[model samples]
Structures are given as structure tokens and as C-alpha cells.
Target: MNPPPINVQPLDTGTTFRSQAYHALKQAISQMDIYDHNDEIRLEERQLSELLGVSRTPIREALTLLEQEGFIRLQPRRGIFVIRKTKAEIVEMIQVWAALESMAGRMVATQATDEDIRTLWDLFRNFEMRNPKEHVNEYSDANIAFHKSIIRLSGSKLIQEMTDNLFIHIRAIRKLTIGQDNRAERSINDHKEIIKALERRDVDQAEHLIRDHTLGLAAHVEKHCDFLE
Candidate 1:
């Protein structure tokens, strides 16, 4: 069976149409479960054009940009499909992300306000009194949010920009694996430790815990996720 059609909003007239359409399409793709075991999902230009309330001309232009960014591929006669990275690529990307996030944690230890730390805690407050394993889906969303909030708390625009693309893959993978191997149960604990380190403003400890937590995901994908092979 075919996966659902790409979701997009009509382009805002105030912005340049092609750029607006490009962002719209990319956002939709990022939210898709491209790693799903189903057949590769295709992107139809006509459908996209109609959905975005634009002509084929701008849709074509927007697609070309997405293609160039390594987000999608266009085959001569086959169709456009989202690009799914191989296991090696996924592991390498996770490794890079681990480095970026660890540094972000260091910055957060030194720069984030007490309220920022509390806000991070708020993400998991409900789970604090319950078992995360019982609510894997909700915790997965909060897990992704927790990492993003840490980056934002770092107060480094460069780090935020660097991890933006990595997140496209990381979020998807985390959602898929969070329920496996009792991972969600372990993840909640790891997050609590990292947050505690940050709260104490322990830079070295925060960096080490954050790096270990992220690198642990890389190791999990490397050993487990055989589908990526």
C-alpha cells in the first residue's frame, strides 16, 4: 500500500514563492517516517503543486532545491523519493550530532538560566511520577524536545543551525527505536542524569554525560537496526 501523500500548506504570498514552497515541502518531508518498512514513498509534482496552491513552475523549482540539498531524489522515469541514509551514514551522522550536542551541554551549563533548566525539567515532569515505558510515544516526542531545548539553551546560533539537518534523521530514528530494548525506560534515566549535571553548572560533567547519552544511541543503531544494512 502507498504511504500517505506529502503534506504541505499553500505558500504565503508575501515571501518569494519558490523559497516558500521549498521550506513548506521540506518541513513536510522531515515529519514523514521515511524509514518506514513500506515501499519507498514517491512525491508527485502535480499533487504537490495542487496542495501548495501553486503552478507546476514554482513546485518544480522548489523540488530542484530539495533535490540539491540531498533531501530527495528524482529518477528519470521512476519518481521522486525521500533519501534514506545507509547504516554507516546514520551512525556517522549520530556521531557528529553527539559532538555538537555535548558542546551544547557545556554551553548550557555555563550560560542557561535557572528557569531554562526548570523548563527542561518541565518536559518530563509528568513522567517523573510515572513509568516512561508505559508512554513511549509521548516520551519519544518529549525526548526529541528535550535535546532541542538543550541546544537552544546553549545560546549558540551556530550550534542550532548545524544540528538542524541532523535532527531530520535523528528525530525519526529516535521515534522508531525508543520503544525497543527497554530503551525508553533507560532514556528517561539518562535524561534525568544529564539534567542534574546541567543544573549544578558542572561543565565537564554535563559535557561528559551528554556525550555519553548521545553516543549510546549511535552504538545502539550500530548494533541493532539491521534493517539499515
Candidate 2:
């Protein structure tokens, strides 16, 4: 099926053309079904220009940023391709993600307000409603939400910014891991325990649980790297 065309808005206030272009392209990648299994999805500069309603200049700039951030590859004599990491690289990145998220959990344990906790509980409720075994996409969304909620609650802007960058790079690995054998169920249970720890405001427990849960993806990806296929 042809992906629906994206309607790019005028640059948001206080943002540069490159920034808006980057955000628009990122949204298109995540929101559209543009990939084919076993084959790299190639995007043309003109197609992106037409879809985003921007000139090729900003498109080139945006693609450059995406390339630098490990999202898309600009191949010479080829085309822009979504980049997938090797199994070992994915495992290493997940470990790095775990360390950052664990620190976020520790910070959020003390900094999160009652409203923040309530929002997290809502995400848990959404996860509970989905059949993890069959609804991998839904489960993945919930899983991302549960962890990202902690990062959002952390008061350190630097931590938030760093994790946001890391999150985008490893999002594919995370989605793939969620599709592994019984992985969604395991992730749901881990979220439950982490939530409980957060509810009790146990900083140590929350940090430890979050770290273990995040690292758990590394194990899953190591065992089932082919899940990405």
C-alpha cells in the first residue's frame, strides 16, 4: 500500500527550517509504513520534497541530521535508507539506554508529582487492555510510554535531551525485541513491578528495577536478533 502523503506545516515558532524539517521527516518515518521486509526502503529527494512541501535544500539538511543521528543513511549513487543496527550494536546500545533510564527512574522517583504518577498508571491501564501476545504494536507503544514517562518526569533537562536522542536511535531494536517469543508478556510484567516500585517511591528499587527491565531487552535481542526480519 502506498503510504499516505504527509502534510508538513510551516515551521513552528522559534524553530529553524532545519529543525522543522528534521521533525517532519522523523514523524513521517515513524508514522508511515514505508519499509519492505528484507529490503532497504529507499527514499528519493524529490519524493520527500513533494511530500513535505519543502525545497531540496532543507530536505538535504534534514537527511544529513538523520544520517548523523544514525536514523537514515545517505548512500552515494544509491538513495536514503533507514539504518538498522547489527545485533551486537543493538545490545550495546540497549545497555547504554538501560543505564540512562535507570538514572531517570531514580530522579523521577523523588521528582515526579502525583499527576505524573497518574499519567503513568494510565499507560499501564492501556497496556493491560491490549493482548500482548497478539497486539505487538499496542504493547510496544505502552512499553515505550511507561519508560519514557520516567524520563519526562526527570527534572534534569540534559538527561531528558540525551535520552530522547538515544531513544530514536534504538527505537527499531526495541520494536523488534517486543516481537520476540513471549517478550511482550515479560515486558508487561516488568512494567508492573517498576510501577509498584515507583508507587512506593522507593528510589533504589525503582532504579534497580528499571535498569534490569531495560537490560532485559539486550538479552532478548541477543537470543532472537532475527526477530527484526
TM-score of each: 0.96, 0.85
Candidate 1: segments with Cα more than 4 A from true spot: none
Give a tens-digit lDDT track for model 1, residues 1-229.
6775677888888878898898898899888877756578789888998889888898889889989888899998998888888989999999999999999999999988988898988999889778898998899899999999989999999999889878778888988899889999999899999999999999999999999999989999999998987
* Residue 169 lDDT (model 1): 86
Per-residue lDDT tens digits for candidate 2, residues 120-142, read 77776765666786888887777
Q: Please give the distance, in angstroms, between residue 205's alpha carbon in candidate 2 and its true position after superposition.
A: 0.7
| Best candidate according to TM-score | 1
Global lDDT of each candidate: 0.89, 0.75
Q: Deviation in angstroms for 221 in model 1?
A: 0.7
User: After aligning candidate 1 to the native by TM-score, how far in Å is the CA of 159 from where it should be?
Assistant: 1.5
